[model samples]
Target: MTTFVSIGSLTGSIHPSLSGVLTKRKTVLNCPIHGDYEAEGIYLGSILKTQTKCPQCEEDQREAREAVEAVMRQEAIKKEVEERVAKSRVPLEYRTKSFDSFRVLNAEQGKALELSKRFVRGWEKAKAGGYGLLFLGSCGTGKTHLACSIVAALIANHQFLFPKYYRTSEIFSAVRKSYVPGSQTSEDEVLNYFSGIELLVIDEVGVQKGSDAERRILFSILDTRMTSNKPTILLSNLSAEGLCSLLGDRLYDRVRSKCVPALFVGQSMRKPATPDLFD
Candidate 1:
């Protein structure tokens, strides 16, 4: 038999009554959701406030991760662009010059091209030194053209060649600039830069009057690069003996010992406004 209890029978005692239906009116101390209901976790009830993560919080976390990834990608691209800019030093005059500019009218010109192609193909390995090139020849004979061509190939195809070009005058000027008041660059800084690059092209080795001071500067650059096992490409418009005299005995010995010799002898490829068609 089921016993039925009423308010008149048990006013101040426990009674058999159904659970009350919860409503929004009793949710004064309710959680953010499921008002006046039960929940799971510490202080488990919907009436008390909880510290659970909100939808907005989760979205924020995901956005933060994406932002970090974006920053990393930007930094990587920035580094690559900086490296490319540093490698590009070809003058506007020679910017468009390529292997196609040369006619290879003689064995020496062809040989220079073959060596350059090999260097470009093998640069990843050759950049660590042991093999370097010395392009000793007259101006307009395509020495600079061949050297610049290598730069073009690497820029177009290779990754991180980091080639640098400097006329012998510009090189010494950098060192001289350090002595000027308020200059940011130092001599050692310039030296470190030239010595540490992947491949350095020093052009016009004896373009002007060769003084003992100039020879000393050249000696320091060459000697440091040699010691560090960095390959260098040298361009000049002088004969071997003349260049040796300009470099002096000690520096020439160091240069000749490490570099493969190539003599570029040909009619000047430069078209006088009328062009030099004579071989």
Candidate 2:
């Protein structure tokens, strides 16, 4: 026969054989471990349901919720950053952009992006390793558009750690100005910014003249990134030969080693890039 008893340690069903003795001993059968005593009590779930909650399960749920919240927060931040990047890009007004209205149109621009993606993807394969690409062609060949599109994609699709876009002269000048006498900024800060980025797109390369001093600073930035294995995107109007003439051997060879040059050959895409021209 089963008997129920309320005693010191027993709060639920108690076997008749042990009930009287356990009651006299101030111990109960089927008693759930209370809050503090939960760890010490040996009770089944059926009895413990009336006692204290399972702390282990409670802790697990809390952790799981926190993890889910963390993931959601990260995804939100990533989306925000991508939107900002897309907005900050140069408007299609100044140029005919193949990446804007049509990224996969006739699959031509898509093919270009795909070729570029192969290099960028390599960096991801190596835990963010690999170098950059130098897109050299005449103006209106969609070099800048492709370069900016890459920055957009890396920020949008790839979730690259931190991507930055700039004209070659802008960053080169910034680094140089920082080293001038009484300047508030330092060279280290410039290098730190360039070095830390996961991907850097430098457009209009060879468009500006660099003093020997500026050349040295430019080399410093490129060499540092190369050694650290950060990828860079170079868009320039200069031919491979012309680039070698302008940047000199050191920078040339370094860029040459890291990048696969894609020569854009076609009539100027800018002459008539609008739908109106087709009419």
Candidate 3:
């Protein structure tokens, strides 16, 4: 036979199968915030102990813990992106540039901004097709600003992407230095480094003297990138006709085949909006 006894808010049971072992009780426990709830209490001899918790409060606490963990994960990702951007070799002046920071003064600038964003959004497809961008216009037209913005966006979105930024003059300078006697680096080493980058941005494209040797060096680097199905961004102040003349037909055609031109037009951003006091 089984026996039951009521004590305070607890109802306890003693079963014949466990006569001298222990007893079980159903007890009502009060929660300050959630009011009273029923819980199971265990008895060893005369001592009764209950494991009590408010189900709703436990659920809320669990959700809060998950929310905190989620925020920490996001912060970690942001920090990683900042570290990678710092190491990406983007110039100090342009490292902080982003699509949101780009100022669109006119419709053309607005179109340019949108195009840059679309390129980032479709980067996987662009990378697969070896497609890139050509930022053209006169100086101070935000060409480099938009280019760096693209690089920054890519770095943030793609964990493993390798991006490099260099001026047209720097490329020639590096290769020229490699030709010096007793130089540790070779010409092929310099060329191969530029060629192997996952994404390459060459700024000031038409700044170099249009010599046959310069053209050859540029051709070798661009041709290798094309063959590897890698993309290259070209930033130049030269008009389309002038750029075509500088690059000559062969290299110009190679660039046109894979690049979507975003022509930025307007006065120089470096120019002040208001008239100078002396003017």
lDDT of each: 0.74, 0.65, 0.85
59-160 per-residue lDDT for model 2 (tens digits): 878999999999999999877765657554444452233355433433444566677667545657533555678888777766776776656555555553
Best-performing candidate as measured by TM-score: 3
Error of 1 at 112 (Å): 1.1
What are the C-alpha RMSDs, in order, of all predicted structures?
Answer: 13.0, 10.2, 6.1
| Better model by lDDT: candidate 1 vs candidate 2 | 1
Worst 10 residues of 1 by lDDT: 1-10
Query: Each candidate: how many clashes?
Result: 2, 1, 0
Ranked by lDDT, the better of candidates 1 and 3 is: 3
TM-score sort, best first = 3, 1, 2
Judged by lDDT relative to the true structure, which candidate is superior, 2 or 3?
3
What is candidate 2's local distance difference test score? Answer: 0.65
RMSD from true fold, candidate 2: 10.2
Candidate 3 — what's its lDDT? 0.85
| Candidate 1 per-residue lDDT over residues 181-244, each given as its tens digit | 9999888898888788777889998986677877778888898987777888899888999888
Regions of model 1 farther than 4 Å from truth: 1-87, 274-279
Show where candidate 3 strays beyond 4 Å: 1-26, 41-50, 271-279
In the range 1-279, model 3's lDDT, one tens digit per residue, is 223344433224756443443556666777899888776666655666555477778988999999999999999998988778778778888887888888898888899899899999999998999899988998898999999989989998899997989998999999999989999999999999999888999999989998998999998998888878898899999998998998778878888999899888988888566757569
Instruction: Give lDDT: candidate 1, residue 21.
Output: 24
**Cα deviation in Å at residue 129, candidate 2?**
3.1
